[model samples]
Target: MAITCGLVVANIYYNQPLLAEIGRTFRLSESEVSLVATITQVGYTLGLLFVVPLGDKRERKSLILVLILAAALCMAGAASAPSFVILAAASLCIGIFSAVPQLLMPMAASLASDEERGRVVGKVMSGLLIGILLSRTISGYVGAHFGWRTMFWAGAAVMVLLTGILAQMLPRNQPNFQGSYGGLLKSLVTLTRDLPVLRRSALVGTCMFAGFSAFWTTLVFFLESDTYRYGSDVAGLFGLIGATGAFAASFAGKSADRKGPDFGINLGILLFVGAYVLLAFGGYYLVGLVVSVVILDVGQQMTHISNQARIFSLLPEARSRLNTVYMTAAFLGASLGSLSGAWAWTHFHWPGVCGVGLAFGGMAYLLNRFYGRTASVIAPAL
Candidate 1:
């Protein structure tokens, strides 16, 4: 399941490192090309709000298989697109259907015992994060050696394989919600309104992912700049360095299981702040960039695992709905971050990007400090 999650989620990120290549192909401005990332995230947010919620109301295995197949077709479409508009439209479809991972996570939580839930979630999320990191690495190399179209074709093939494997191996999860789809959608509002932990987790996740997205979306441009003059292969290699954070996911999960999730959450925010501080000097030195990548990824994963553990524990029956609320907000933040990162890069360059990231980290820290206590208290009981 973890591997499958990682593979599907990887589709959304392959375009990041290839942004320069794609832009060159279409003769697009940096701002126009950046919309590929932003719109993909927007499509993901829509999926979270609409498709992921169906996890609770449908047979999960079948749902996952169907979505994976759809995503594969979308990837094919992206690979064949002759114009930027066609590619962008295909990217949106890919984002919408690649949400199979979100469905898998809640299903994993449902299967695990409370005592081991965090650990289980951590393991699966490690795969997801590693996929996020490695997708860039793989795509960067492939897109550089072959054309960008080849990378999307490769992703489509992988998704087809995953679809077959998951179809055979995945367990059937009976629908928990018996209501109509309309009611299921309506209930999302009620869940958000009544659950303080959901609200806080969603807010914190939003800010953290915004910072994360900002860094990644602008990184290719920064690397291509005169200051660095690095290629996509080097840009992709950073993903390997960032994989250090995959280790933090398991540790954070175990830590949350042993202690309360609050400790890990707080620690994550501090690391986020420190990461940006280091990244502020990244343009000057390679070491600064490497160290910042490790710190930033670790911080982001830690916060993510902790927030998820807390939210999953809140509603046993409503795990998918809770995830829907949390992830929708997170991806919405990602969309905003990608847009803002492109803008900052265009107008102010690397330092401006770092400033935006720092502001986002600061906002997350402040939100947690102010509301975390109340949310924590209400979480376990919800």
Candidate 2:
């Protein structure tokens, strides 16, 4: 399940490092090519809303299989797209169906014993975060050496293989919800409305992810500037540095399991803020950037794992819906961040992008500080 989650979720991130090449391919402006990342996140948000909730309403394995097939086909479409518009549309489809990881997460949570749930989710999330980080590394190298289309084609082939493996290896999970799909969807709102913990988790995740998206979406542009004069391969190499966080994810999860999630979450926010401080001052220094990447990724992973650990503990029967609400808000923030990052990059360059990231980090810290005390009550109820 961890391998599957990582492989499947990697699809949406392939475009982040390839935005420049993609722009050149279609004769697009920086702003226009940036939309590729923004639109993909938008599609992911939409899928989280319309698709992931079905994990509770339908047989999960079947739903996952169908989505995998759709993702593979969409990847093929993205590889063959003749125009920027067509490619963008294909990217949206890819994002929508690539929500398989979200399904797998709740399934993992449902199957684990209470004491082990956070560790299980953390282990899986470590895989997910590794996929997110390494996808850029792989895509950067592939997109630079071969071509962006080739990268998509490779991703499609991986999806085809994953489909078969998952079909055989995945255990059958009974549907948790006995209701209409509409009722399933309605329950998402009810879950969000009633659970203050859900609300707080979603808000914190949104802020962190917004900052994360802002940094990643504009990173290539920063590297390509006269100061760095680096290629996509160098941009991809940064993922290796960021992969340091994957280790922290497991640690954070275990910490959450022992010390409660809030401990890790508070530490994560502090690290996030510190990472931006490094970035803001480091300018184009390679050492500074590397340190920032490590801090930033670790911080993000810590908060992410802790948040999931907390949310999954609330209403076991509704893990998927809770995930739906949390991830939807998170990706919506990603879309916003991507869009804002593009605008910031175009108008104000690297400093502006860093400012946006720091601002997001600040907002997240404040929200957590103000509401976190009360929100702790929501997690232990289950």
Candidate 3:
């Protein structure tokens, strides 16, 4: 499941480091090119709303297989695009179908015992996180060497192979939801309304992800700017630097299991604030940027892992719907972050990007500290 999640979710991030290359290919302005990344996130959010809830109503393995296959086809389309518009359209479709990991995650949660749930989700998430980080690294090198289209071609082939392997290894999970698709989606709203923890968790996760997204979305542009005059490969190398800290994901889950999700979450948020402080002041230096990437990634993993552990404990039967609500809000933040990062880069450069990241971190800290306390009364400590 971990490998599957990693490979599947990597599709959403392959465009970040290659954004500059894609823009060059199309002769687009920075902000205009950024719509590619933003539109992809918007597509993912749509899928979370329309597709992921079916995890509770359909056979999870089959749903996952179909999504993966569809994503593979979309990747092929992206690779063969004749125009910028076609590439962007393919990216949207790829994002929509690439939501397979969300389905697999809830399935992992459902299969695990209460005592093992956090650790299990964490393990799967580790793969997902590593995939996200490494995809950029690989795509960067590939995009630089073979062209950006090669990365998408490679992604399509990998997904097609994964589908065959998973079909044999994945366990068959019976549908737990007994209702119309409309009813399943309606329950998502009801779940959000009734659960304070769900609302608080979603908000905190959204802010954290927004900050994370802001940095990544503009990183290539920052590296390519006059201060550095670097290329896409260097931008991709940061993904490897960030992946070095992704192992913290499993530690975060263990911490959540042992000390409660709130402890891990607080620690993560503090690290996030500190990372931005470094980026805001020291980002002009390559060494400072490298160190800050490690801190930022570790903080992101900790907060994300703890947040998932907290919400997954809310209702076992509704785990898919809970995830749908949380991830939809989070990806919406991602879309907003990408759009804003491009605008900030256009207007204010690196300082503007750092300012946006810090603002997001501050919002996450305040929301988690004040609102999380109230939600804790009703939420399980796990």
Candidate 4:
């Protein structure tokens, strides 16, 4: 599950480290180059809404395998793209199929006991975060050395390997669901409208991802500017530094198990608020960049794990659908953040980008505080 999910999630980030190269190769301005990030994110959001929910209705194992295969084909197509439009289209396809990871998260939670679900989901998420955070470094280094096209090919190869592994190793899941196709869509609307579990979880998760997206999407631009000329290798190293978020995932997951997702999430929100303030100050210096990266990732991933723990606990029988809501919101924020960050980079440079991060962090902190108060009253009943 970990390997499978990792490969899927990595698709979103592999292009980040190579953004500068893509811009140069395609004769693009900063924001235009940013279209690479924005387009991929938009694709992922679409997949989250459409592709991920299929896991609730289908045999998850088969569904994941098929999506993995399709994503691999997309990556291969991206590698051979003859024009920017083709590349962007192929990126969207990759995002659409990468919904496999969303399925894997809920699957891990479902397979575990309620008390253990957070930790199990965290363990799975650790791999997903690692792939997300590290792919930039790997893609950056490799993209710098070999070319961006080769990075897609590499992703395709990994998809093939994971697909074979998933096919052979994953056990078949029993079918358990209610309603026809129309009813399924209706229930989705009902779930979105009535479920506090989905509402707060999706909103907070989205804000945290926005904070994460704002920083990372602009980071490479920072590195390439006059302040630093270290290029993609250095940009890649930040991904490794940011892997601290994976460790925080386990910590947050375990904390959610011990306390509850509500408390855990608030703590994460506070952490992000603090980290971004530090980033506001540190945005200019290299050492400050490293420090901010570590804290930022840890805070972001912690909130994410907490949100998953909360939402998955809400519906044991429909974890996949819940995940679809959570991730759809997250990817939407990410999509907006990528485009906004690019615009920030163009107009305000690092400071403008910092405003986006601060705003998102502030929004998350306020919303979670409000929700936490409500949750306190809800908890006595729980």
Cα error, candidate 3, residue 10 (Å): 0.9
Q: What CA root-mean-square deviation does each model show from the true structure?
A: 1.8, 1.9, 2.2, 2.7
Q: Name the regions of candidate 1 deviating beyond 4 angstroms.
A: 372-382
Error of 4 at 151 (Å): 0.6
What TM-score does structure 3 among the candidates reach? 0.97
lDDT of 4 by residue, 212-329 (tens): 8988898998998998877887898899999888998888899999998877787777777787787778767878878888888888888899989988877677777778888899
Error of 4 at 252 (Å): 0.7
lDDT of each: 0.91, 0.91, 0.90, 0.83
lDDT by residue (164-196, candidate 1, tens digit) is 888788989987888889989988888887788
* Alpha-carbon runs more than 4 Å astray in model 3: 372-382
User: lDDT per residue, candidate 3, 1-382, as tens digits?
Assistant: 9999889989999999999999999999888888888988888998998999999999988999999999999999999999999999999999999998889889999989888888999999999999999999998999999999999999999999999999999999987889999899888878887788888889998998899999999999999999899888889999999996569989998898999999988999899889989998888898899999999999988999999999999888889989999999899889888988888899999989989999998999898888745543433211
What is the C-alpha lDDT profile of model 2 across 1-382, one tens digit per residue?
A: 8899889999999999999999999999888999999989998888999999999989999999999999999999999999998999999999999999999999999999989888999999989999999999999999999999999999999999999998899999887788889888888877776788888899999999999999999999999999799988889889878999999989998999999999999999999989988998995899999999999999999998999999999898989989999999899989989998999999999999999999999999888778645543433221
The 10 consecutive residues of candidate 3 with the worst lDDT sum are 373-382
